[model samples]
Target: MSTDNKVPEIRSKGFSGEWAEEILGDVAEIKTGPFGSTLHAKAYVEDGHAIITTEHFKSGELPVDKKNIPQVSEDDYLRLKAYLLKVGDIVFSRVGSVDINALVTNKQEGWLFSGRVLRVRSGKIIDSEYLHHELSTSRVKKSVVSRAVGQTMPSINTEILKITPIHFPLDTTEQTTIGNYFQKIDALINQHQQKHDNLSNIKKAMLEKMFPKQGETIPEIRFKGFSGEWKNLTLGDLGSVAMNKRIFKHQTTISGEIPFFKIGTFGKQADAFISKNLFDEYKAKYPYPVAGDLLLSASGSIGRVVEYKGEEQYFQDSNIVWLKHDGKIDNAFLKVFYSMVKWSGLEGSTIQRLYNKNILDTEISTPERQEQTAIGNYFQKLDNLINQHQQQITKLNNIKQACLSKMFV
Candidate 1:
């Protein structure tokens, strides 16, 4: 098919039809919440009609507990009952850099929208689910924010919202099909996300139980073959730290062939780079990270680690700390043990930092080489599974975004 017409550039198979252009005022009734002063902090109470605000902008079923959201009296609710939300009504936050909206389900019926929100009732023209999905897409959201006015915090008025364009298929059945498809996708995304969270919690619990706590020589749990007290060792005993060479900002280039890595760029692509001459000169003389070594970030997110993967890169000085092993430790074993470590002297400190000397001086517990290898291998497999699940969720989300962009006009 040719691409010049109003037909979407891409869409789901078996439906080559195009969407029709419509305006928001033609298909929906738009209105803002009560006046700013009408709903104040003093209006909140222990129990009554729940006042939905930007905080509860998440569209879907509300939680059973409600988590102690502020409420209002019956009289106040009756007076502002005109602003009460019902099934199929979508509400948006009037202020904020990004446009935030929530679809009011049957469960959210009878809840009043606070002054900061704008409620849009799709009047028999557009499907509520489809409209919400359309508004959420980057295409429409950027348009919405572009019209917002402010120096620091951009905001939209109801006039700009009313004239906002809406484009979809003329057929209501087609609208429902698009809406239902996305609704199911959202549910699937939520399911995978919950599984990812559960797996992470399991790993954290295992890290706690399988390792020895402070002042204890033996772990609470161990592998099948291991049966004895763990060994005591300071970090210095495991390996010595190799510090990076001092490279000034002027020596680095924004666009260079050699990748110069800092603590910020560990595990990510390098934004800064050094000349080939500089890298080769430093690689031989200075104490630097090499293959089979673990890179420790000593600032910002202190103690974060990433292993050197034989990539061609030069490290930043003082910011990154690397371990030069002495054949007394396994890299995998050090990684797992580091995850369970609780750094001291960081409390109430303005700038959180872990100097190389302090990390080297910290005491740790360890098991025999065989047991350490087994435990490390097991967790590595578990981590691989976690990454797989998380990657699947990300892939699904990307599919949803691609569909939304092509399925709508």
Candidate 2:
């Protein structure tokens, strides 16, 4: 497992970092996508030929969902079959979310291409998978992002794509080996991602059952013989929303401290992370969220809720609202309630704007303090399990990436 051994370093140029040249155009025949109306999907029919587009490509592989393959008549296939996709053909997104790449794996014989994507076919000098990996690397991604020309939605044309420089091993066998290795890694990452998604669904189901419905006083399941009606309350009556006023100019030096979370960090479950430092010299200007404060994203990505676990060292000023609960209301209960509100579409602007006042006005039904504790504790355990699985998936993906970087070279 140790990657300590030094491997061969191949420069793009023939010389050692002095006369670097472009790897793509030299090794592949890059073709601009068809622009004429000859490739329209209306020409396709049921049981039609497979058609590829930017939408079909996801995370370096073709996604099965959202597939839009159209059936081309035998006559039409003759006119357009040249653009039909084959195994090993590398597809690249040329427009929105530019530079996304996918390798064709499904061997089913009839696949076509759309105008939004480009096909990169290799010459005798290069392997298709190797070139695909080169296009997908972080270095290449940066280059592609830089080379993309448009101001609003940047994109790279086929000509620019052909000249895009890529670094790779000179040996063909090594190239194929590296390509195949990363392919396996990509598959594993997708698998873990799917499992993570399933676990999340399970947690959501558990939450729905644990919490009472709107205006319902008693939960479907109660502890032992205990039974009590939950109370209805307005968020403003239970707690007050506080906005952070401080701002941080620099985020680079703030790493090991607490992360200041903007509304962007809020997710369906909790705030993704904490801020480490505050830029505003006035320390008390922004509301400080302690271990029990409920953090809600008040703007963009509305309705994300997270309980402060004392992990973040700091916070920032953005579209964020902090809810400090009164002693009568449990913080955990508030967290669950916020989650329920989000699920019910109660908070956030009437027009999708997220603000503190919108959340304050949200109506909530709450059980007694003891019952709230029980429900919160139940969901907390479930959330912990989901987090554990997520951590494992992260470790596995990191291992895959390391293997990719080392095995390729």
Worst 10-residue lDDT window for candidate 1 reads 58-67
Clashing pairs in 1: none
lDDT against true structure, model 1: 0.79
Q: How close is each model in CA RMSD to the real structure? A: 4.0, 7.2
Give the distance in Å from residue 58's predicted Cα in candidate 1 to where it truly belongs: 6.7
Total clashing pairs for each candidate = 0, 17
For all candidates in order, the CA lDDT equals: 0.79, 0.65
Candidate 1 local Cα displacement, residue 288, angstroms: 4.1
For model 1, residues 197-283, the per-residue Cα lDDT tens digits are 888898999998888887888888888878888888888887887877888999999999799887778778899999998888888
Question: In terms of TM-score, how similar is model 2 to the real structure?
Answer: 0.67
Instruction: Give a tens-digit lDDT track for model 2, residues 33-126.
Output: 5665766666766664566677666556675532455456677767776787777778888887776787776653357677788888877767
- Assess candidate 2 and give its lDDT: 0.65
Model 1 Cα RMSD, Å? 4.0
